[model samples]
Target chain A: MSTPVTSNPAQEESTVDHSKIKVSPEEMEAYDQSGRKPVLLGFFIAVVWLLIGTVLGDLSSFKFDRPDLLTEQAYLTFGRIRPAHLNVMVYGWASTAMFSVSLWLMPRLCRTPLRWGNLAVIGILVWTVGLGVGIALLLAGHGDGLEWLELDRQWADPLLVIGAAMVGASVWKTLAARNVHHLYVSIWYVAASYPWFLIIFLAGNMPFYKGVESAAVNWFYAHNALGLWLTTINLGLIYYLLPKIIGRPIYSYWLSLVGFWGLALFYALNGMHHLIGGPLPSWMIATSITASIMMIVPVVAVGINQHMTVVGRFGAMRYSPALTLAVIAAMSYTAVSLQGILTALVSVNRITHFTHWTIAHSHLGLYMFVTLSLFGGMYYILPRVLKKEWPSRRLVRAHILLVGGGMVLYIVALGIGGVLQGLSLLAPGEGFEASVSSAKPWLLLRSVSAVIISAGHLVFAYHAYLLAFTSRNSLTRHPPFYELKPVLVKKRVP
Target chain B: MTRILVLIMGAMATVIFALVILVILPNSMLSDLKAPPQLKQPGQQELLGRQLYISNGCIYCHTQQVRDPVFTTDIHKGLGNRPSVPADYVYDAPHLLGTMRTGPDLFNVGTRLPDRNWHLLHLYQPRALVPWSIMPGFPFLFEHKPTAEAGDKVLDIPKPYAPSEGVVIISKEAEALVAYLISLQHNYPAPDSDALEEVQP
Candidate 1:
């Protein structure tokens, strides 16, 4: 390992001081050039999708309070818009953002400039086109009716699969040509996610399954899309960022090993827990519940590893927006994973299964955990690649507070309302309409929260646009400005 | 662990194991499932209605699966006579076993309210039937005629929901949708092997 370790605090500090280590300017420049085009393209596309998806999500949430608001057009109806919003956010925004992060991180970790950069660029463009066309088809009333698989199987899905493959090829090729002897933990996660995603995506979209089997496959794909794909990449990013920003090695390398494998083995079975109390076999649900509970092993391992690493270095977040977002995202991962385990239990699933509570839980995972991590990744990568600091610190602070505060309100409102709605549904005396009435106020609050989140996205989009396009440079370069001037290096060749 | 190939193989093996156990095994075990005698294949119009249901994304709000009566209140709520079974959905291609219940379970909605007129009116304007309903009215599925023609199925929309200048007539799409909704009955007794046993308290 290149980094030194010691038990003595003073000696350790001196040994691990970042400035003492030499880095070749040419190598760093090569890494930046290799990733600049694909990463920037992916980020730009992701921001646009984020804006569009947020609007669609806001409109869908509002429909709960006023169903007649946009009923004039079939395309504008709640059903179409809701799925459109979900797809746009998941595929267009989150996946693209993640791809960009992976593209940037892989080269840096491998100690090699990225290979096939042009192919990665092509992949991003193709994925963007596929998503755009798929959403249009969905709005035009040609959806596949499966939740996450709403994109047309023949027309849109093929392009996505091919596009993702192109990007994956680039990532793998970069990994194969690594200069480093020991692969980082992040490499395992980011690399494994591509194949895992491909397997589940193909398996879920298969047309053969019928009846309860289809539901089984649907959720297996959907939940894994979160666990193996989204969860894996974000966790990998956090593992890298948390330690890097704090200028320390991870707390325990063994804990990371347990966490990574445990996630892969157990998360796939957790999907069946979503169908608890439904028509599926009891044994299937039982296995899933067992697996869901078993997720605690990985969740806690990851939790402790990240927490201990940053315990004394909490002040580092003040200097780095990326660290701030990563810390929060790591916390959300623990919270959402624990909540998921509880919800998987039969008793809890009985209440939250079909209610808005599930929606709240999903947002906590997707928005709080995954999206925030992506934002942090972007904040860190954008400055380095663009050779500029964020245009305005005020905009960064505003983006954080708005999104963070909005999500807290969103989860709380819908969480309580969903529980009450579940109770009402279970009460023999209460009519079904009572359940709807009970959730109405919370649904309205959810709409308000959506608007807040949309505002945050708008702010983030404008800031990103300025950082990428405009030449405005901030006088005060952020800390870790060591990259801009490599004068501290005592010239060393690898 | 440092080798890329080892990492890839290990990851792939774990997911394949999951796929086998969760998907392949369950599918093989349920492969012998036979549709109950009463669960007939949907006719031409009902199939058309099913298409309409899928296209309009009705499955987003409405679930087709009815939960266990003993564990939940699905039976007491009149969603189904018994818990739905694997055999109950043999005809479903991409199963409409929805996740959310923003509206209500529609697995046995056909058996609950079989009245064709009520369904037509409900589709044209949900508030006409249930004042507190948040379901969007499918006005595009109905026509606004100045006067009802002979043999036309006119929706009995109440005031405030009905158009001020014209009569509301159910179009073929609405009729097909209603037909599909009304055909959701699965009250047939599931085979003992496939049936979900209620847990005695």
Candidate 2:
């Protein structure tokens, strides 16, 4: 390796020339290969948790329509199952997948080998144990009973914090020792997310905030966990993967800055939409509504940047699984955010506040936007880290179609059903029970869609298993479309 | 950007935003809040029932707070008599102001449906009573007795939902849950809330 360039500390400026970083292709490739074991371990764990989460999510949804199906088993009761499903999905699947991507991305971005790969493995193990304990207690009837904060913080939370801290510290250390002078926008997102996670996780689980204040803090924690923790990292992954896959810089660097800062400024206040008609002060709700609407700024900024960059690269999406998923995720991010702003408006909130529309909206953000983007990141990262071709092109195609189909069915059924249920609730003569009954068909359909999605998850898990373990000699293509280049060209809007 | 700028932005958004909006502002505004005359601390039975309610994630389906009619239709729908204020929830230690109304608002469920027997039977098998309630039955909170004991109160569950060979007696947990459900009355108006209502057009 070239002698380690130790420049004077005072020469470091806010903007460093990207060309001066001097990270040779070999160095970059070495960094990518270094994270192989830990990242794959994370993916394996995440897929397994996703399968479990899908089953539980389906069982929980089914109970809403058919309450008598598993009444005998307390563990399978809808109440326990619902929270368990949420925890598993959010903490187990989504978070684990995010960690895997972050670990791989940090090393590449920093132009350094991951400093503590073994620590991340240990952290993942600890987190799995914490999740297991939390889920078991929830099923055994011992949860703390706050939305998103259901896991008993006293016992289970510290383990999570410790696990997260171990992983987070490793990233920080890698960043600190970086030979690169300038940090990318993606680095800004990844670096900022860890602190936000730690702060919110601690504050949300604390016993100090009580009663009405607790409700406020609860939303603060819940919404920010999605926004700051999940949204931040996934957006970072999108920013990284899109440019790398398409072999081009983002359309507008300044717009990316606006998008990142806008998200950092606005997302904390948006959680109060969950409390529009709540017992809090009206001004608080209005402020939150205003912030929620302001989210369009960042959403549009990111949308323009990503879309403009991919303007002429539509054909590249066919070969790159990562680009295809990222494009879908970027589009969903825009759609879901605009939808969020509309739902937060007083007129719409009056009709849809308590209905299934909120559920549909959340899934649009979580499943379509966050989870799908992570899937794309996984597709890109796995082959690079493993140094082998993906075993089956058909499996990846099948996984995408399955998830896309299931998600559409799930969101459409719930969206239409939520509107019908809301209007029925608003209509004076219709009894409340009638609204519940009217929603049964839609809820049943949601359960069916969940099964379809679960099938996609199994296929993904099986494919990942094959890619991780199968020998290199058995693969058809050596590098799996490594010579791919930009195939889409931008056209003038006029 | 400098590392300090990153730190500042994250802090301003996550910590400072929550401090100003969620904690400082709301707490300062509602500092004068006191429970209305009718609202009281939950009794021991009601507390146990509330625990059961929480443990079972009842808050996921049922919301407790009703909104202002000027903004929404909660009043006209008879979900609550007036807009709930912070004072309405002062006695509550852990406020259950749920987000979803998959079931109707339970702020004044006690006043709307107060019959004790109705609650017990309804909890045992919601479909048997309402014929279309999506709520899960709390059979785990009740027990099946071969015959009614000397002091046992047999639930009048409908023919289909009734245990095939035994009398369904309300267990202690069900009794506590019903007691908690019955104690959810918020019909009486607080002075501050009524004044706000009078000011509205």
Candidate 3:
């Protein structure tokens, strides 16, 4: 395992297979240097927001069990803090983390140094300030009524829209100046996310759309923000990291085409499923449900392709932090997508809609799938950019266990509590208070789970701090292939 | 060039399509929608209450729309007298048809539960009425004075939730919010609400 792999410059012509197997040292160094500053800044800011969101989430959950806990103060009330928690997690943590990875990956995949690097850094600064201001306003009781778009549009939207555009423009410039001929699948995914994000952010925050229609637009933007922006970028990162780590190409290149196109076509229509049994026309909901069911094609295609790539190399997960989180995230991708499909069905939607069951489903998608995937990608990317190694493998393992275990406890309790609540609401003679009472035990459990999740965030934030600022010489220079079998496996050809 | 086009266009079209279905088409279809027969514009107090509701993020927990009985028993649960319709919300700007039903639907809450005192008490301390409610009491919206003044309306809060040494008085904001809640009554017949067919004998 201590044996160093050699890179012979002339081997690009001497061996056809070897050319594809290794990236040139010069290219690797160039890719590593590109977007280094913005990525680090993003990572730092994302960790800070993550910790804040976790604390807010814990306090909100605690308030559910004991309403009087913070009733003395208006700003700390559950109504304000709950939305504040969501905004912090979604916009502050998820968006910034995705942006950081996308900034690095886009330039690398294009074989070009990031253009307008200064603009990207400034954009991040603006965005971070805007998000903080928006959150503060929300806490101070200036929030809009929309679920995900709670920040006041007049005050907050311009900063976010402009800041995101500046950051995204740099990535597009990098894409336009690509040194490579063939576009990788990951490049396609990353290229698409920035534009999609801008369009939706503007459309959702527009002042004209109102009444019942506003609700429709709200879900349209909210769901697509998750689908096109967060989910797409994470998928792109996985596509890049999985093969890059496991020393192979994607299992089926053709299958990726099917998955990408399927998602692009179907995911938008599926947003209306959130409005099932709503005041909208029946045809609208029916169309959304159909689109939702069609999501299975993409989900299955992507799932099969990703799983088959790592079929025999499950051992790689033991060694690679990136691979471990990516695999768990990949599994969760399938689970959440299928779960979403079922939940969109009319019968299931009847029972689950407006219940905590949907909350569990969303956490499955957001926490389990998107956040875990980003964690994996960051692990792989941060070391390369910083020219250092992780300070502790124990911290990485601890993060995985804590986050994974907390989500399981959280989702399960919410799922059962939601079902019971839904049933109690539906029963002819059951009182509303009875349903409320039944969810208390689960709500208390959720608070405990939040504490566990917060611990995981602290561990990750500290680990990142160590990797970024501590002595570069103190950490290992080589990749920590802790569980690989020293050398490449011999192919057993018949 | 082709690759860039496909990538950009592929992403762009998703939002465009969503806008068509969710925004444009729905707006065009319901563009002529007016207030239902029994609908009236919210008065100054009710509008203030609506703003307070939005500011407080009540929409996070209490949805304002009740689904058809086929999909939910919200009507049977006494959340509303009938299914809510788009026209029922024509006068609303930034409609608050919330997603989660953590508490009961409040579309017809004002009609079904008419006691202003009950709402005031419930808002001040939810557990005073329902022992197991997880809803946080809005203590900030009420003041606990040593005694009620001439014009101050005293609350009849039950024991334990009430303060030991003071009378609970509802603030003006609480009063406006209650006025808005009562104004939410759409129990009147509407073309889309199925109000005529579903009338209780």
Candidate 4:
């Protein structure tokens, strides 16, 4: 042991093959070639979806600001379009774009190329057709009136099945063509998410759950989609991208695996927490609450892992749009999930459930964590996918500032409004009318934030059009002003 | 070695845990969960109106579950209950708790707006009704095909897609929505004494 002997049992000296460690020129070319196009296409589509979704959202918000904006037109009513806006963002904008990025990222993380590129284009088309029909049906007042499940059953069921079929083929192909062995944590998360959705979504949306039982299932599906599919996949991507870009091993891979299991075990059941103290069974509601509170384990572990990995190396925030949005999303996830656990308490649920307070809680997850994370993912992805940097960094800077400020203002305003509404109605001798009045101001502020978000979306649309429509060389010549400072990754351990 | 049992148990716990979600599928309505409300009487029109509310998706926005005296959250915005009773909906086909207040909870609206004319105007054009309402105008409910402008028709109206124009100043659907709204109250057993009337701060 005293001698540095290679064969000593006590001294477990490790030998690493430098040849395997370094990527050969051929390998580097393969990686760059594989990573570039998909990410560019994914980000561009994401920006377009964001543009349209944000416009619809602003229109709906405008109804609250001046409820007479589109009174004559039935389709544009807040009642009709609120669900439309949500679906557009959920499916058309965020999820689709996320899929594009994930397609590229998943393959890269697994050390493989995308399996069938042509099929992906087919999947996008099929899913788009489904969404277009679904949106038109909703606007036509043929909607089933189920939140998130509003798509008429005729359109919804087939759409989900087809969407799954395309994706199933795509994911399987990617997994089989792997060039590396120890599959990364991001791949694990993304892999677990898809089939889980197929099972849960099919079962939950099954027609056997009719009437109020179906309502319960609707809430269950609505929430689980976010938990199991959207949130999980986004977090998985971040886990891969953050460390790889920063050139650091994740702070603790063990913690990440634990977080995965904890989340998978807890999140699906937490759906019933929304129906606490309602008509649902004591056990059903109680289990939801328990599962929800137990969620702190995953929350803490993942939070610490993501945060610690980025802590010292966060100066990458200046140059990388993905890192900046990703860090914010990480922080928001911790905050939102912590808030989720806190709100699940029965005493708190008494004040929060059935009020705008619940709305406020949900937005923390949707807008802050899911939306921002996906946005960050897009910002990182589109450049590589489109084969050109963004045409204007000013637009990007303006976008971040506008959207971040808008979200904060929007969330805070709605939160304060929701709490007041809950407390006021709960207060002894208070009238329900008073609760309605209290929320009005917050809705008004949210409308303002919606305008801010709209401006940001417009800037984004212009950027996306440049990528999607314009030539790559033209964009390169007109790169955003912020790029001029030559924002490169900041390495600290000199 | 014993700790290993706990480890296997721990990993196995998640699989067993999911079985709980399987049993929760068939759930009870809000009316089933609570005691019957203390209301004394409901008018004939209000009863018929509630049936219309369900078939038309009015219940999608109007939850009927009134908060206890300790809380009146719905009362502030223009809704409330007089302590809901199972009996109030004893004649109901589907008990509407009036969840989803995208418009507003309508439990207490009846007592305040006893006038039938106002509700008619509001339902025809919700802006003509409540200009600031985000509620979609139910132009489809009013009769465009066979226009009637005289009186309420009590029919076994089967087709939900077809609009029913009553032979009166208002449509039967509009009347039904109003009748349902008027049924909403904060005092189920209308307080004989003014002092007993619940007041919000």
Residue runs of model 1 more than 4 Å from their true location after superposition: A1-22, A474-476, A479-494, B145-152, B193-201
lDDT of each: 0.87, 0.81, 0.83, 0.64
Q: Which pairs clash inside model 3?
A: none
Two-chain DockQ for each candidate model: 0.58, 0.54, 0.52, 0.12
The candidate, 3 or 4, that scores higher on TM-score is 3
Compared with the true structure, what per-residue lDDT tens digits does model 4 show for residues A1-494?
11121323332211111112345446544554664554455555556667778878888777666754665555766667777887788877777776676677766654566777657666666766777788788777666555666676688557855775676567657876765544566766776666666655665556545334554576677767788778888888788667766667677766887787898788877877765544344566677888999999999999998888888987767666777788888888899999989888877866766666666677778788888788777676666555577766766778787878888888888888878867765665765456667778888988888898788778767766766677854547433533434233334322
After superposition, the stretches of candidate 2 with alpha carbons farther than 4 Å from their true spots are A1-23, A472-474, A478-494, B2-14, B28-32, B147-151, B193-201
TM-score ranking from best to worst? 1, 3, 2, 4
Candidate 3 residue-wise lDDT at B152: 95
Ranking by DockQ: 1, 2, 3, 4
Model 3: per-residue Cα lDDT over A1-494, one tens digit each: 11123244443222122226345667776876878989888888988899999999999888888888988778988889999999999989999888899899987777779988889899888888889889999999997778899987878877888889988998899989976555678887888888888988888888887678888888888888888888899999998888888887778766787888888888877888988887777777787899999999999999999998888988777678788889889899999999999999988888788888988888999999999998998899898888788887678878888888999999999999898888887778988887787777887888889889888989998888888878954568556546343222243222
Docking class of 1: medium
Summing lDDT over every window of 10 consecutive residues in candidate 1 chain B, give the lowest-scoring window: B192-201
Worst 10 residues of 4 chain A by lDDT: A11-20
Instruction: Return the TM-score for candidate 1, rounded to 2 decimals.
Output: 0.94
State the lDDT of candidate 4 residue by residue for B137-196, as single tens digits. Answer: 555445453544346442223243223553223556667768767766655553232211
Please name the candidate that would achieve the greatest lDDT relative to the true structure: 1
Native RMSD of candidate 3 (Å) = 5.1
Candidate 1 residue lDDT tens string, B1-201:
467878999999999999998899888877777777889899999999998899889988999988887778988888888888777888998889998888999999999889999888888778888889999988888888899989987777777877888788888999999999999998888655443332111
